[model samples]
Target: MANYNPYENMLQTLDLAADTLGIPRNDYEVLRHPEREMNVAIPVQMDDGHVEVFTGYRCQHSSVLGASKGGLRFHPDADENEVRALGAWMTIKNAIAHLPYGGGKGGIKVDPKKLSERELERLTRGFVRKIAPIIGVERDVPAPDVNTNPQIMSWIVDEYSALTGQWTPGIVTGKPLAIGGSLGRNEATGRGCMFTLLSYLEKQGTSIKDLTIAVQGFGNVGSVGALLMHREGAKIVAIGDVHGSLYNANGIDVEKAYEYANSHGRSLEGYEEPGMTRIPNPDLLLLDVDVLYLAALENQVNEANMKEVKAKLILEGANGPLTKDADLYFFEKGIPVLPDVLANGGGVVVSYYEWVQNKAGFYWSEEEVNEKLAKNMKKSFEEVWAMQEEFKVYPRLAAYMVALRRLVEALKIKGYNG
Candidate 1:
């Protein structure tokens, strides 16, 4: 973290993927830089009669595929570099999911939890007003990310609609169902992780019921992924949050952990079970389990801690959970990783479906949505797996190869329109 830059990390992976794919540097040099980056000043009036100004950013990595799409988060560390990296990753994620979209991401550097509901709404509206000109239902769409959720998405939809004077739900996804949100949108990312893990196990002639797993991060994506894997009969021996980690050698009751998290502001700080043990946040990844579900943030498992990871497989539940060096280390160690682009793509895949429903005024049932998500995630995994086998490369590079190849071909077919 002392010298970690998310955008630089993204570029490193992009370069590695391109080099492995044997594509000309010119073919992907464009991806090294974002197409556009928008930073804005958001001024909000607090309940105490004071004005606080917040800095926010939105970056569009590419639009060669179609309109740009990604999530927007409110975090204390949100900045241009992080947003740029996230947007670039979104491009590859969309490509791997085979969706007609590019990548974009935005976030304000603030803790939303500290803001009152009214104040948060004002901040949301203010951010939308500044980014409004460049974003639209067909141009760019933003959804919720860390410390953001459906209620916040509803605010985004309302503000964007008010600015355009039209009820355009397509401008955002992951909304409450009443506002044209797709069913299963909330748990789509986690569910997609579950599907990918199951698919991997099925391919390996193994059973999920016998696996011991540890998860880092107990928020939306992490908790949902934990619960789904639990349903599959996997032993979730450890789980963690921003506060710290929880472990039970036999298995932690994911249901109780999840319920407690929901009841306590998504933090696992005070959670306890009969045999549960509290460990340092860093220790969660070192648990000698069958799988390490990295659902936290960037730079968590870089060189400083890569050697300590004992999981045989990793499911990237968060974007950039493993840095380039850690990722390559795992690959060299013969550990299989379901990379973020292919692993956590369920959120974006279902987001695409939500946008489609909004465009058609037709929504899907929860069962229909889950089926579609599983099918898409499984397909992407299989494609990435095939690429891995064909090139003898790690899953992450293989996934990037698949996505980068797709983007490059699209560029070749489109050629210079100028």
Candidate 2:
């Protein structure tokens, strides 16, 4: 993993896709870097009557399609390089999903868990104020990611509106229901993964009920994905979060586990149940399950641990969870690894819906939102599958091909031929 940098990984993938498509180097070279990057220093007054400074970043990878769109993560590990990589991935993800938007991502270098509620609000508002000049409904929209959530989004919307002196819910996605947030927005990513998996299984004459799944990363994406898959009769044998891992071959009660995690401060530590055994988080990755859903951070499956991955199918629910080396290893070993650009695009897809609803001032019901998401996800899966077969490449490269073709066309149309 020493040689792995998220931004560099994105560039290598981009280069491969462009070369495969025979796109002129000049036509797609701009995509090798972000169009704009904004770093801000946010100073917030703490509840203890002290001010703390935080560094934040918002990188707009591309807006060739339309307004840049992505999520804002709050983690101590947040930095410009990671944000740039995530932003670039968003560009690919949105293109593959066929959304008329580009890619952007923002994050602040602070641990939300260490701050009080009031302090978090202040920090969020300060970050928004600092970055508001570059973000807008028609410029770039931000959403929830990692430690950030709907509540933080609400704060951003309020702060941005206050700054502009107008109600601009369109300035952000993933807001509360009372706001302009679309229904089914929270579960969009997880549900999208489920839909993609089910569609792929059906095409192969297999049923989800017959597969045993182990989900690493029990956060919003992982927990919801595990629950939805479990609801569809999949046996979720193991689940893990930052705290620890839980295993039960007979299929742990997903709902109970979800509830426990939610009520226990979102950690699976000390959770007890009959027939359940605790395991290390890394061990969860080596579990002998039919499916492995990687919903954790990037590079979780690197060269060091690729050989130990026993799951027949690896579905990425997190961005860049598998490094290029690990991805190539899986391809060589004939293990089908679903790339994140296609699998975890549900969040951004629903974000597109939310953006639409915000512009139209008309919101759809949860059923409608989910139906649209499923249709889009299925369509994207078919397209990627076709590309994979046509090019005889892994899904990751195939996805990059699909996205690169779209992006290149947009660039050429915009008179960037040179």
Would you list the C-alpha lDDT of every candidate in the order shown? 0.91, 0.93
> In model 2, how large is the Cα lDDT of residue 133?
90
- Measured with C-alpha atoms, the lDDT of residue 42 in candidate 1 is 92
lDDT of each residue in 286-405, candidate 2, tens digit only: 999999999989989987899999999999999999999999999999999888999999999999999999999888999999999999999999999999999899899999999999
Maximum-lDDT candidate: 2
Candidate 2 vs. true structure, TM-score: 0.98
Off by over 4 Å in 1: none
Model 1: ten consecutive residues of lowest lDDT:
409-418
Q: Once model 2 is optimally superposed onto the true structure by TM-score, how far is the C-alpha of residue 399 displaced, in angstroms?
A: 0.2
The local lDDT score (0 to 100) that residue 54 gets in candidate 1 is 99
